[model samples]
Target: MKRGYTAKELSGKTGMPSTVRGVKARAARENWPGQRRSHSKAIEYSLDALPTETQIAIITAQSQSRSDFSDNKQCFPAKGKSPPFAATTLNDDQRLTMGARLSFVLEIERMTAEMTQKKAIATIVALSKEHRLDLFLHDRLVVANDRSTPTSTLSERTLKRWISTYREHGEVGLAPGRRRKNLTMPLWSTDFLRCYQRPTKPSVEASYMEFCEKYTSDQPSIHQVRRFLDKLSPEARNIGRHTAQQLKALQPFRRRTTKDLMPCDVFTADGHKFDAEIINPRTGKPYRPEATTVIDVATRKVVGISIGESESSIAVIDALRNAVQHGMFALLYVDNGSGFVNDTVREIVERLGGTLTHALPYNSQARGLIERAHKTIWVNAAKKLTSYIGADMDRQAGAKAFRISRKQIRENGGTTLIPSFETFMAGIEYEIETYNNAPHRGLTKVRDPITGKRRHLSPNEAWARAISTGWQAIIAPSDVLNDVMRPQVIRPTRRGEISWAGNKYFLDNLRDFHGADVRISYDLRDASKVWVRNLSGELIGEAHLDGNASPYMPKSMVEQAYRKREHGQIRRTLEKLRMLSDKNNHMSIVEHSSAPILDAARLAEAKRVAKALIDSEPTPFTLPPDPIAKYQLWQKLNADICNSLPLTKDEALWHSSYQTNMEFAAMRRMFEHIES
Candidate 1:
């Protein structure tokens, strides 16, 4: 016998094609033994391994066969042409059940191949009875008699039914159909649920009752309605019941980043009410003071702050000035507070080459950095105080125990518990200093090149670093700062003195500018001095309040004085009305009686009443002498001498008459004083 033969040799010996390609093709078509690679990397058949007779039979079979090399049993039929029935509809569990059913059916079919059908059935039943075929069962089959006990056995009828289902619809037909319930609800319940889920957020019970009244039938119980409502999502239930601001808090928002911003590039400002109470300097009452703060967005440093009774434009301006001392910022971001949105603030920002931007209404998140600072710095400091009224304080117990009213404290002489306004401000300043010196997590750590030591960056460190890098702060002059921050009013100066807020402001600088409109800027907190600015925005000089004017006068004293003068006029008018009434009564009696009853007693009584009224009237105070008035009189005289134009005969006569009338009026005033 020969060793393994190549395809060419085998083809030649079997009387097939002679060429290698033709022989290889014939060998492949015949499903012959596979070829193996030899040591020389040439293809060789292993037909020589088989017996000579067997090889001859294989060659004869290959030549006679007309099929392809691949086995027909290994190939699957194309889908949809002849697929396993309903296989696509079965899930994994159902498929496993169906597979087990098919396995058992196949076992029965195999057993029946060599036996009678009735005998096969009986054999399967016998095997099931002996528990030999239990492994092929879908699951543990329940026993019919004991219902609680489970066994791995199926009835003969069930086996027959499995076989029948397989024959009709393949494996999928063995899967149990899904069971469904015939659920029904009242019509009113459906309507109520519909209304309940709407964005209007109608009350569950109310909606249910309304549905019942409208439909007049099939109303479900209120408890049932509540149960349905409980099934709804909380977010859905709160839809229209919550405000837009509350909804915004629940919605997703993008966090802002200041990574690209440099120190002094932007600053955010906001006002916070200090959580603890301090004694008001002016009122001596314990009250929460408003703290206006400006924080650099990049460094998270409190650059400027002002403590005031309320948040006002002046407080905001003071904060800006403080922040500007460190460095002039490029932009200012603030909320839509009246203080932040005014013209003075806007002008100051523009003058410093910066822009002021207001955050969206009710959107504190836009200024979240500064808002967080308020809690981190001010609120934390407040927590240490006994007068803290923060939300974290216990309302029922802690508040009642710790919170003391201003009146109660004053009456009880309890000054030990509350700090004065100055002390509170000093505490705030210390907190700010500590905050600026503390390491900020938002700042990047840097290693000192000279010391080779790592240092955590703080607000103060960042500010210093920025300044060393050539950043310059645009600081306003002290005079300009005082002028711009204070409120300004255009008032004409008379006699080198301008009356403002019930006080006269006089300056030698205004001597030459009498009757000229000048801008007077005065601080709200201090009325001792006012700045006099020319029309061109130049600071001419400072004017001092009159020595007689009270230093502690209120800012609204101008309006108060006007009100007092009007009240005095009203009293005088009332007195004159009484006198006129008495005179009118006497004249009416005189006209009706033919004889004028000018009784001496009546005249004396009337005269006494008139003298008492005159004496009761308040005496007017003397105004201080004005040098500007004398200067104006001298200027008028000088102008008259320089005039060369001759007056007409009628003008000269009128001038003489005007002079004679002035002389006569002066003589009459002298005579009247002498008589009195």
Candidate 2:
């Protein structure tokens, strides 16, 4: 940056005169290319014009000077104060001023080695103007000097003042008053703040309108208000503009660290509805299944997971119960879902000597880890399935797949693409296992044992690492776990059975407690059985749906309704066949099975044998299911007209005759009303 050096600075260089006047005399005698200094008689000689040996010495000295300037860390503090870098007992701004000036002193001292302070100051001003200082490149010097203007150059007057102050107070004298105090706060600062800092975050123009309305007499101009408001600290300016909850995203939050936590020190659980459709085990229909997952927050390892029809408190517990089988967590943090905030989860957490902490209501951000896990594990896997119905899937292709699946089911053809629940679950299990074994980004990084490349620890590896420490998890006893995991609800035992989730559970012993209000608790899965408890927490007995019922009987009203729908569908199909057979209803479908005419003698012998067999062995007979019952089934299934099974020929004639009688017509209308 330096074009040249003063006579005194150049004098001590190798092969140059030792005295300032000697160097000046030599410069004049050699006809050196030099320029006169501003406000001084001394001359600055050009380095290129100087002798080659002198030039090399000067350049080498300059290089060392600048290096030392950057490395200088000495702080000249006030009397009786110990020297410390930044932790000294000085005011914060005072330390920064000292630090900046100490660095400045180093550069100035090197320049003033054999020269006066004035000469050194002139050199610094020249170098800074040419953008020569390392600090000048990035505005470090300007920022230290507290300059906010567009210009990068420092003025001579400012340089003079800094030198004078340093002479008087040593290093501490460099701590000047900050320039921020120049801008003045308006008297209506409070009112302006109130108007501008609103939750709606109205623009300055809109807020100015409100301010004008509030203070009609002495309101400042919009520009004036904006200038003063710009001077306000960011924290103050943003206070009311963002609600506490809204500010959380922008605010700095303390992280809950996992380094001090063991494998099961904390756990979080959530349910995610899989994006893919799988065969609904019961109905054989395409449906999305919800996966309830429990994860060890410390290791980011999934300890338990269960995929079911829908998300429920039962699902939450079932996942947690699986988690406890490995190790009980010390704490539980989850969103404020009904499944998590219930007394059941609370009781279980307490039983494990831990605490259940629900996040703020409606705060989805609280489930961040689990939600991300769902994307990495479940969602990515769902995208691989043919039955996937995720939003991102191609619309035409997804619709085609959906239609194909349903068509196959409707036609009684086995599905070709949509996976059965069991197969889909097996795929899900593989995904989970892979997730656990694969490296997780949140885990601590380590050198790969085989490759020697850095990689994050896998969930399983992290878990094992935590186990290697002295920490150990408190395992829950099986009996205690079984007792606590069963979430209890009060239900009345009715007619030797208890109804739950639209399913009836019966046991012979339950009949004694009929019509009694009993506490019922059961596993989320296996709804076929429920444990009956008295109000006092006494275990009464376990009731099962299979009790006293036919092996194939519908155990629930849901199944009963399904059966009714099935029969109605069959009737409609039969009616369509009957129409195609014969409109007169003379040709019965059973007639196709009748034996053809045999030879006369053989037919007579067969008839005689059949008669004897029928006499000897009385056979069970069942009336044909109403094949003709569907004549009116389709028309009036949901119609406003009267609903009835098809009437036989003789019955139709009787019905017509009865309709003529006034009393019969009135009665018939009553029946029709009931049917409708």
Candidate 3:
């Protein structure tokens, strides 16, 4: 055989690293057994001249022969180092004969080069047409009819087996094995067999096993049966993780379809558990509150929700409001929780634009969309929580222990608890936003028939559409109470002061009726603000709860007393000043100065009256020559310009043009001067 060419020769031909294995595969597949050259002018290399693994394999096979003997005596010593015969006894003729034989073999090899080259050329054409000659190492043959389904998960060993199977039998050999028969076991009807069989589903051997003793009077040995089962096909005897996977793969495909529900035509709202803490209403403490949430059926987006300590109708109402704020819905699908069935809640739903419906009484899957979103929000919030070390030291420390473990998920990426509610809410918002925009896997990239987008319209967007369709109805704040809220009557306390449950409230306008009767109506859900009305149903005022009576009073009482105190203080101060002035100045001040000292009290009153008069009809009013004079004395004074107060040039002009009170005109000119 010819010695193979070096790595450089292969590089010159194929520009690929020369490997003995590659050479062998080429020699075997291309039928290039020895040094050979065929279309010499072509780009192809002479395989016979190239080094190959087959040559190396042949050499390795003849290793024992090389180790056993050598014609040259000096080359290797005998087992016994000193030979008994003289070294010269070895003849040149015998060596020459051996050399001639080797030469003859080499000459024969050289002569067959053309024939081998021709044969190799023939083989190459045939192989190229019939077989791809595709060879792979430790790798897999992943086959899938659909590209969307992953084909990369195939294992190396499995692939090698598949390749071998394919080589022997072609495409038919690559078929997945049939379902295992032994794994099916056997089923026999017996007296107890009926007990294990479900009302629905198959009656399997395992299900009937319990009755074996009673019906057969003896149970078959499971081990023996298993051995018998092992005699079946390889698939039948297979055990462990792979068998389970195969069983699942064998199952017929099932499809889940969503109904083409209208926007707000149906809604799903429910509360789900979250490993989170919010203020507990019953205890007035923090605990993991149920996250009440609702979703729009058409958009498949969260519409309304509330995070609170309880899942009462109040919470449901809050979530409903959230959904309602965007638009009205026709039907509300909810879990069969006590809160949903409550009369108060039903009334609220009916009063609004929606009617309540229960999700499959006991099965939660009916409302899977919203329930799933609740879980998503919970998980997303928890994930965000892990990184949030809150400002509250105590909560921060507590949250470290509350961290979510990703291992618990059937899938990956669970959220951990964070200390800050604000941060948690922000994360929730981001998640919802992303979820709404993301293209659903089932929808592919096809445009929605309704909105012409891969994603369904978001709640707000869908609501906008509904509004265009004349489905939007405004539920005023007052109507909201009767529509979706529980009402509570807040009657005035015995003191004619209303008590908003535990908090006190008063009507500033009803000061005289402080000890009389009044009634107020407010949503029982939130006791913070109430509507004050008389015995009749007319709304008179709005008042907030009084929590503290500091500053020696409630807001209403304090404001009242402050006004009275202010007025009295001003009256007394002005009276004192006016009395001093009355005694010191002209005795003609007798009328009102004697009436009161007339400090800032009387001056402010007079100013206010004058301002009102000027604002209303100012034309008819006539001022005295000197407005400061006593009224009786002024009545007798002349209406002549001589008796009137003196005016500046501008004032004189204004007085002449407009009907004027000389004193008042002087006041206007004075004001104008001050402004300038």
Candidate 4:
């Protein structure tokens, strides 16, 4: 019935364009037709350009203006407020709308006492154009309903339905979102979802492509598949994307409640590799050491820590010892890691009168406290070093620092870039101290006396509180701890000594056990001595590394071996150089010079030696041989000259011998003169 109203009148009813300028702007934005009033500069605007919900609000205001809200008491007798429904089922806007609808039904019912329900509604609509209703109900009820819906508005049929819904089901029934109904997943959606629910977590479009691979007629389109997936619960949609163990993260999980726990009640342990590198004591190579840590669950204190080349059995045992020294725990909770599940760790737990419990495999979330502690403590500590090689570390920078450390170790036998063993241990200690003293969010808040503000308790504060409350730690006897923590291994007793860990440890008692298996427990820190026990657990006496092994320290032997090879190489190189120098000296002098070099002593000695050599080899002087032999030789030579038949063998031999004989010197000289 109302065709036009002033901007203020419209805003009062419609709950939009609340200010004068807002009305003008809304009119301009929507191209609303308007006319300037002759009485004032204000404008009167038609409802056609406004949203349907706004139009309905202005009409509803007219209905309320016709009669007092008290006028509705006869048809709906004044009663105490009905019980409040479970309003949580509806969102804020939905809840406001349900209230507005119920109010409208009550107002309509009052008007019904005088006339037909439809005519009563019509009469109120006519009066609202001339008059405004009470500001309170109009603003709270009418405007709230107007603002709730976006373009849609209430109608007589909708009002009638809400009246019935409210009477039967209370406020929750009026909110469409609160209504529950069956949502049957389309059968064909299974095929599309099958492709989508792959481990690769392919996109809807990619999944559609794969779904079309089978070429079935009932296949859903990509958009349809997306719509179906939108209806699927997150867990169902992601079932294939993550393993079952991982899926628990998406589901509800109980926080490991540490509220009731006391200090030393439960100790949770985990291992982390230091991000930065450290020098290995055995070899100078840079490496990341596993920092096995123990944390008191209740106080969140870092009670113990052990760093090693890996989270080995020894490392775990040592970490337990370190933790027990701080406070003996009733239970040791750790993951199913090899280092945690081994017999040595179990033995140590037994000695301390504690239970060893392991978390389920792949469920690290249960040990969230210690795992988080590793990040807060060890991770932060490692980043302080220059050689940090964490994943988030700057790639080029970390690599550069690592190269520097490695190069130093190779050429200088040590490096400052990587932390030294002592420095590393000290840093870990400082970090743990800082961690224990720092405030933790997991702990309950306590008032800070200094600042006069509530703050979370630091681990140290928490531990102290527990201690003061009469909670005490059970300390293991020193001798018992020492015996239990020692690592035991069965090694064959070789020769008259026990050989273990590359060191031959000798014991007088062990000689009788030679060629037999003996259980030996040795301190990792001190390899100098080992305790040998029989297989039956009887003491077999202590053995020392120096006994019958070698006179030198074992480490010194390694150093000596290294130096020995190095010095030998130097000696061989020097020998080669000397040989080369001797030959080179002579050849160089002779080849580079042509001048003759002589000494007077050299020539005189040469002459003296030559004279002695000539005297010693003097010419032979002897009497002549028999004249008959000489004559015979001459006759034979004369006959040989005349005939090739030659002289007889004896005469030929005699003549040859007589000619060569120095004893026939006279005849030889005569023959020589005659031949000449």
Candidate 5:
């Protein structure tokens, strides 16, 4: 209906640029349909004659340039204000795409403010057709890279839909809806997932088949089922299928922070069976020795280590003794093995003014630092040895490779490729020294504030730094160390002596403790001495082995000796009984069949025979009265005899023979001597 409008009339109606020359330039740039004459002629432009895109562009530019329509305060209608669409409606990348689309639409709205509703819609459509609005979605939307194919531009309908959404719920409403595939899981899907998540851990095809058997309808493809399972987090997928320990191994763990700890604050101890075989000192056989190591948590430094035939409470105590040499620690962290939970270890910790803590059962991960050290120091060193038995080694192959016969070794000059136990221990020691001196990633690099020198420290350096900063080691005295390190047993003292391990240890201080129970701490290797402490842990005194008791003898030997003595006594008693029985039998037989006169004569004959038998033997000479006085008189007589003369060799021999004969004759002539 409106064929033409003058520039001033159009400017007054739509609030566009007021000057005709400026309007002419804008229309020309947008390629709007218009007629221009000479300077004297009036230029006329028709609204219906212009192209749709150019008309919309001109209207949009005019609307945006006006001051009255610049603000966005009055865009929404007033009922209850509609809430903005949530970002949760889309995934991360989709949300970003939606945000970019909303920004584009808002810019179009700002530019097209003066256009009528229908014209603005037409302008948006025209912009979409020319691909002018598509640049705003650059990098935000995914597209095919083929340049031969036409660019995939947004549809006018889609653009209008976005505009309507932005108008309804502000910028957030432009976000796309939930993806079609993720809307709802199929009816059989839940059961299938349950099967997959069971402890038996059925495969995807297995679970799908089971689900089909149970439901008999609405079965999902195996690929679909696999996709569903793949979407779950590793932990969820493994929940019921894996053991708690296995799951924990897969999951991440928080590292312990040692910022507040000083050297000797905590010590972690663990026993590791060495990977290489060596001669067992006790058995003299090839064996894998268990080594117990104690490490300071703050420095990651190995404070002590003890290698033995096997891990035991005694071995743990020995390691603790070695660790105490470096410094006393406040806490001991160990696993719940029998060696760590014993009363001896607990008592030792208490005596050292510290606490012993056992890690959670079956959770070796808690002691990961020490475990890593085991791998670094011990396992690495073991790989160099010929008898390595690591996990990667095939069991049968490793056994064959390491097996060397005793005869073979002897033929080879009594030498074996395997290191001796002592050499193995020395190697371990060297590894520990290297580990302590090597730079550790756990320690922080720091600069000395006073010296302005930067230090990247090893474990030992860290420990030294801590010590220099006023950390004092709570070391036990030698006596106290000796007392705490040995194993303790409570035994009662008898007659001022305490018997331990078949050896009786006696001390004058034990006199007061006789018949009293005292705690005895003695080293198994040296039982010659034992430390006696009261029940209250007060040291009474050290006791040494009794003189009569052999320190080398063990309890079993002592018991054997006692049994032998009892057996000898029984044998002697039986011999005497047999001899007495024979004599009684002979007497009874002789007296059984005699008349009274004959019996009297026979008894008198028996008496005479007994007297004759008795007279045939030598009698014991009685000591003379006043033996000391007699001895003095004899000494004087002997002096007088010596002063009289010295005897010749033959004469001396004859004199000695005469003395022996007189003695023998006196014993033989007992009846004659008595009568005389």
Candidate 6:
């Protein structure tokens, strides 16, 4: 039975009468279900307080007793709408409760609510009938599976509308019928046709989006555009993994073909980093020093190589010299490493009369020929080299130890060791020679591509060509063949003495200098030798075997000097300097004018006086009257002649032959007659 309200609520609603007899008791007296306390109150105070509606509502609630509504479930379906498909029963809670995990339920239920009540039910029914429906992405359902879902399909229209709604009101569109879609306007038939005509490739889709962003001030949403594109063709759907791989594989992938490459025309030298280590005799340790090499393109050979502690200019020079042992080169290709870009390397190349060219930074393909050759060294020789257990210099040191140990074994035990620099160098030489001589599969010369016989060249042959070609090219004169290739060494002097190899010469008596200035004539081809001469054409010394030559000075520096001296430009420069010095009073000269002046004004006047003196007849030094006095005496007589005298060669020659001779003869006769 319904529980009756207490007196407090009864008094508040009805009046004192209703409070006295509890609303339930009043209801009973009023012929109501005294079960409804409110009905009793309404009758008790019909005029001032309780209304008829209030009484009716209270009685109605009380009439349906708690026993009659024993079950908590209501008559309406649990969540307002029935589940899709046949009536089903699952004791799952649709509404949220305290302490419940609501994340999954809220998301799924929200998705379900977003669907049109009819369409949402239809999707649920479809999903129930066909458990394999995979297109219920987020809140949208896939209508048709097999027959291409045309853009006209309601589901497509619904999705397009839903996306529009989502953009306008955010995720609120996912909360059932609160969504509104964009209005679709008719586009021109031509534009519609052109849109579908686009290539169905995914790249095209990406490029189209990129184009839109670039050309259109307002870019459309990519998700919407992608869905729109989905209606175009089956090919626009997606690309398969196998298809992508096939496209990538279709491109030629064989190591770049360098068949047309020839020897000496292009050469590459680089420092190769190695994974393994070699023995160093000096420190008794093993280290993997850089392997610097210069290879010939035509011969496919390692022309010059220097396995040094580092790739230094000296090392590069040494390697180049080795390559050019047989011939000179026209062009040298290299990378942009510090060792390659430095002045030292540039000087070396320029001095040798060779032009150095650099590959694009990070572009190894430009030097593919030599780069390919280096691969063999790693694969064939390096891989075979027993792992070096000691420091880079260990082999030499160990060898020494072995030698000493051998001797020690003879005397005492086999524990003695000898670590020396010479020993290490020798061991290095041995290893290098063995590796170079070992035949390589790639290096072996087979029949020429044209001849189609056995290989035509070997690595050694290529190497030999590197030296030979470089030598031949470099041996010519720089003017004729422009061979400026050479190396230089700097040597100190004792008393203004410079040495090359061993012998020393004094610069005091050198022909090119009065005292200590030693003039060296550089050789273009063989830069190692320079001629030393003095200012008086006397050879103070020949630099062939001189130890005074400086090795520190670059070959290019020496070559420049040689070239300048060869063309006599150096002498010209010196003369110009001297003239400038004299003009500035840094040098002194004797004054030839009648008077010398120190002041600027007086100096100008003195110059005019000197000019007048020069124009006058030369005076006899001994007994004749002073030229100035004689000029005063003869002024009248000579004035006319002086005025008419010619200044040019032709005019002077004409007067000297006839007119001047006649005048002089007449003067001589007149003087004779006067004297007589």
Q: Specify the poorest-scoring 10-residue window by lDDT in model 6.
A: 90-99
Model 5 C-alpha RMSD vs. true structure (Å) is: 26.4
TM-score of each: 0.47, 0.50, 0.39, 0.60, 0.57, 0.30
- State residue 285's C-alpha deviation in candidate 1, in Å: 2.8
List where candidate 4 sits over 4 angstroms from the true fold: 1-88, 109-119, 128-183, 489-676
Judge candidate 3 against the unseen true structure and give its global Cα lDDT, from 0 to 1.
0.50
Model 6 Cα lDDT, one tens digit per residue, 592-635: 75432256764455445545745675544321223233223344
Model 1, C-alpha of 639: deviation from truth (Å)? 78
Write candidate 5's Cα lDDT for 408-488 as tens digits: 555653234565554565566667878999878778887756688876578988988887988788778987788668767
Is 4 or 5 the stronger prediction by lDDT?
A: 4
lDDT of each: 0.67, 0.71, 0.50, 0.72, 0.69, 0.47
Pick the TM-score winner: 4
Candidate 4 lDDT over 234-347, as tens digits, reads 888898888888788888888667899998999999888888888775565778899889898989988877777887888888777778887788999999887998887897
lDDT tens digits, residues 1-676, model 1? 3346666445433355647787677667776576565554556667755446647855554442213112221112222222234667666766656666666666666665477545776776787677775543434333211233565556677777666555434556666554433345545545665555555667766777677777666566888767655655566456666666656667778888877778889999999989888777656767888999999998898988887778888788878877787777899999999889888899998977899988898787667788789988999988866677789977875556454554468577545356666456556766787899987877888886778988778888887877898866666677556655665779899877888866788888788998999998766456788888988888888899883356476768977998999878755655565458668777343346543344677556655776687777765532122323423433344465469655445444444443322223333344566779
- Candidate 2 lDDT tens digits, 197-228: 88888998998888888975677888888878
Candidate with better TM-score, 2 vs 6: 2
Q: How close to the true structure is residue 132 of candidate 5, measured as C-alpha lDDT?
A: 65
User: What global local distance difference test value does model 2 have?
Assistant: 0.71
* Model 3 segments more than 4 A misplaced: 1-216, 223-259, 281-284, 386-528, 531-541, 545-676
Model 5, residue 474: C-alpha shift (Å): 1.2
Give the Cα error of residue 601 in candidate 2, in Å. Answer: 25
lDDT of 4 at 528: 85
Candidate 2 lDDT at 14 equals 78
lDDT of 3 by residue, 377-469 (tens): 665554344332233336755555444432322233222232223333434555566666654432224457877656644445554565787
